[model samples]
Target: MSTQIITAKWIVTGTSRDGDIQMLDDAAIAFDDGVILAVGPRAQVITAYPDAKVTPHPLHLIMPGLINAHHHVGLTPLQLGAPDSPLELWFAARLAIRKVDPYLDTLYSAFEMISSGVTTVQHIQGWAMGDLEAVVGSASSVMDAYADIGMRASYSYGVREQNRFVYEDDAAFCDRLPPETAKKMAAHLHRLTMPFNDFLTLFDRLTDTKTSPRARVQLAPANLHWMSDDGLLALQEKSVAAGVPMHMHLLETAYQKEYAARRTGTTAVRHLEKLGLLGPHMTLGHGVWMTEEDIEICAGTGTCICHNCSSNLRLRSGTLPLMPLLDRGMTVGMGIDEAGINDDRDMLQELRMVLNLHRVPGMDPAEVPSAGDVLRMATEHGARTTPFGPRIGRLDPGCRMDAVVLDYDSATYPYQDTDIAPMVALIHRAKSKDVHSVLIEGDVVYHDGRFTRVDRDAVLARIAEALAKPRDADELNRHALREAVFPTVRAFYDGYLQTTADRDPFYKGSSRH
Candidate 1:
């Protein structure tokens, strides 16, 4: 637990009222015992921690580790061939061709995320009914990736009853299902829900893993909208009983809101509130179509909203009122959503997009979020959406030594003002290559384009092998019905695909969704 010095030309703390966005020069961060011990002038810190190790990262920016509030990490490889279909159709088709190996995808995704200085990701993992042993048989490689690469992560598997014929088919779209298929799916879920060994084993095994001082685990209830009323309520209760956070997709789009309202005689968010599922322990993804009242209710209940900005833009799911949400006292953070559709898991890109997306429609863009706001979303706010909220995010004293050093020489070039330096440089230009090094819990997981403790090529190869395999009959059935229903999904969404593929600027380029 010896101390260390991380001196940088620019120190962007992203904390409230932390002077200008950037330090004048030679800013130093000192940490020991897996926690930051001081933050001030380089000369002062050097004098104090003289016996501690000194790793000067000058000509770069040192800041808190980036957090991804929502991302489906294990799908990194299979995202290559994802059809640009509507929401439900796209998900169904994608599921059919999912890579059988969750470990590889998780590894590759973690490596990519780490290279970009994403020290933590709240990753969503989907598994089929019968793939218990395969889906997440051992979270070792993934947890290993985090430990060795010095990143933190959250993982979840679920009891998602995706009735294939539920969307579109030959008059078989009702709740009724044939005996065999239904029975098999049910039995698979039974086993999947009960296997706590892999998660438990990984957590226990990786207690001494490389660089993971802030790592943690939690139960994720995939989607409340997709689950049955009984199932959804049961998951909420279970999460509450286990003292874990309940994460799910809620009011993601107009269609979802419409469907839920039709079924429960109320809006989706309202329905959850009435069911007692909305609370401090709940974190909902998307929240794109939430009404003002719904927003107020969430704030009052202390619920966290994960705004998946990139995914919503790509899926044509409409825009979220981020300003209003923040103004109303809601604890909001950003998520990368599912991998692939505008799908670069780079949280820096997510922050850049968030800043530009809010510009005035036809006025000067000077009023948009200053770079400080964007940085906060990725660092401070992102951490608030998970279990490590208190201990990570900021670089203040007593926080974990999880940090990233950005090379101002490459992706960042020619700094103008020393005052607004970090904001102007980072928000405008932050490439994955700009990351010089990443540290998790005072251990260097990545440095100068390579991981310190893992075989990068082997991980990529394993993910490729898993995705190269084919889907069996049951998985194929799920894919076919969902893809076939693409033509009937609220027509406008069909037009959305045509417009995107055609790159048509006119809103009416296609006549559907």
Candidate 2:
């Protein structure tokens, strides 16, 4: 295929050798057959590739596409009637959410993500209910949605072997409830249960039958409390054998920390390290309550972390010690989780939130995140946590040509001081509406407020029509069970952490206090 060159007023190529943001002014990128061939000054590129067809965006800033390193579900929980609550109680409340068609639901978020310059997402499918075949079918729909929309996705079926509800055995927890509620809970758990081997089969099936090059399946251990020790070890082995990475949720809340102590008499990180599950291939999601020692373990093991700032705040999970993680030179990716603070999946807004949220007390400039650091989290660092890895993160030679073009004029409308750096200005001023175009695999999938593949409005309308129907008997029953057992679920964690001194306060009071 002939080379295509895209020129922009400014280009953020990637990070430099010194770990700073790399930028090229009046630059152009030349690609052929979906791989970058060269990125340099516009005049140099034009002279070198004189015959290449050039597309010029003199007022745009082209940058590597943003990656949502951690994501789950399509419709926000609030839209599905699950109000923000503590992480433990939120699971119960989510059981009542109205069912949505997996394809349309996935598309709903894909549209939002693409509009905000997110080109890839690490979609961890969790809480899937039904037999193996049915679960596989739902997973297929999710993958198909991304393929149809021309967005890359790293998908994983969460391997949850135990503790489907509370951080206890399913049978044991059900036995403690009222007889009727016990029966209902047992039935509900039964639907979600599949043999451990079936999870392996599901992984093999997805691995062997991937429909699109844009989609790759990985493994997720779900959470520390959600999996047994044996299951986690087996998963680690499977991940190594298959050459795929694993994203596991760990220590998102103080209660989870307490649960880990109660279960293993140690921190979750130490327990995982003992089981040989901590490594570069492993990404721990929401390390909100990680202790200093836990951080050290992760840092030593080269384990990645996906920081879900909005989810942590929304679920009342404590803020992650992001500054310390960065200080340790650990790789951290950005994730919006179920939804961002505005109940939408907007990566740009999420980046801004992450940039400002960790500004702790005292005036240590080194403690605060710079625009380059936040961008790295959303782009290259986020990419590390996914199966796509380095291939799709940077706009460098040998990397996949996945990028976003922002209308610099629109982003800094009225006037922007010339002295202000482009990267800093875009981070603070850019909105989703300023996204001018998006390219994936050298193809323009979105441009000038339109998607090249699939009808977003039509898909959204179908979703609205599907959910407009009245609740069915099965739906009503689930809602009733959720209501009947919410208090019980909440009570399960009452004082659960009160007795544990292992818990660390998110903030320490001043000496005067």
Candidate 3:
């Protein structure tokens, strides 16, 4: 195996313990194949491995690559014409916009995500492709796209099969279809949990064959409110059977909480518990409305929660009690949640947002959430939210050789020995442009601003053209998508009659849903 060494001014490895934690000035790392063979002071490593290729990262800060614990990479196109109002209003708009594929959406989102120092993403794709088989097939094709780009992805073919709005499932609109379309779709979705299924299967296989292990694979149950009782139960069963972590949006808003409570006569978390779904295998997203009891349940079940700071803030969903969650001993990861909200895909900035959002009046920023806490959320804590944990987060010898080097000239540069140096420059000053290089599973995928494997510009142009293609929605769909879909969706929520006083203790006079 060939060896390479990267020397930097500071190596602020996101670590807690002093020994394994690396912060070497004038340090050099020796790498063979795709793994970090050794790390120490520059002269020590270089003198020890005379034959190793030496590359100076040149006045840059070396750190672990960023992980986006939550994503719907191709779903950004769904936001194009989404409604003007909050939550439900936007859901209607999102539903209309989803029909447009353009294929470019996935490439565009991926490029943006990679450029921002995010080497890994937990991906969920396509709500409209309800038939299980079609979902698996389409997702397989998308995985092919990711492999070419050298992304370490935890991908799942999202299966949210519910018989609801016409826009949600439009098999009837297909003018011509194979007689076995229904059977095909069902078989495909079911096989999603079967061995080597959908996107996850392809990713897992690639890593296993790894002449060197290359990528990460994770399974997601999509989100709660989107799935039916049976579907949710199946996801839990399937996830446990596969020994993979389950991802889902737990409680993002009052509407979801109330809706689930009414249907199940209990909170969503409790309902899952009754179904024997609560366990270490589950990783939930959001949890904005989780009751104290729910938080306790999460702690007991050993479930990790990924907080998508930008999406929640973008949709005006209230800020989460991060300090409280930390106090409760629940692991938390950070996420961007596609569509470039928080405005961009920069995880460092998102981490900074996590810090600032949790630190408010009277609450001392130091006490509420330190920079170290946010940094951990982006790495170790973030990894827990996916199937691959400790293996990828740290810079230990055996950990995946995935890390990012931040340029010292960036706005967040000149990190001092203070507690905030790592967090401030990381969260505040750093942007994708400041990223000097990125390595995932022992390979450099992003060198400077260019992706090493994929042609970013060509992929982007194709995406722009395809995104523009989906807006027209054809015939019964095209006309209905533009004019009737939003109102119909809005009508479903608006027409929902409330029979009882909201059980929520924090219920306000007005309903945001």
lDDT of each: 0.67, 0.91, 0.66
Error of 2 at 502 (Å): 5.2
lDDT sort, best first: 2, 1, 3
Q: Candidate 2 on 365-468: residue-level lDDT in tens? A: 88677788889999999999998899988999999999999999999989999898887899999999999999998989999999999988899899999899
Give the alpha carbon lDDT tens digit for every residue of 180-281 in model 1: 544543443354343434433333343334245455666565555446677677667666665667678776766666566656776778888888888878
Where does candidate 2 clash, by residue pair?
Answer: none
For each of the candidates, the C-alpha root-mean-square deviation to the true structure, in angstroms, is 5.9, 1.4, 6.0
User: Candidate 3 — which residues are off by over 4 angstroms?
Assistant: 17-22, 98-103, 128-133, 163-213, 363-367, 412-423, 466-476, 495-513
Clashing pairs in 3: 65-403, 82-93, 83-93, 100-470, 102-466, 104-463, 132-189, 133-188, 412-429, 473-478
Q: Between the candidate structures 1 and 3, which one is better when assessed by TM-score?
A: 3
> Candidate 2: where is the Cα deviation over 4 Å?
17-19, 502-513
Q: What is the full ranking by TM-score, best candidate first?
A: 2, 3, 1
Candidate 2 vs candidate 3, TM-score winner: 2
> In candidate 1, residue 364 scores what lDDT?
47
Name the candidate that leads on TM-score.
2
* lDDT per residue as tens, model 3, 87-136: 65665455445443424555666677777778778876645343345654
TM-score between candidate 2 and the true structure: 0.98
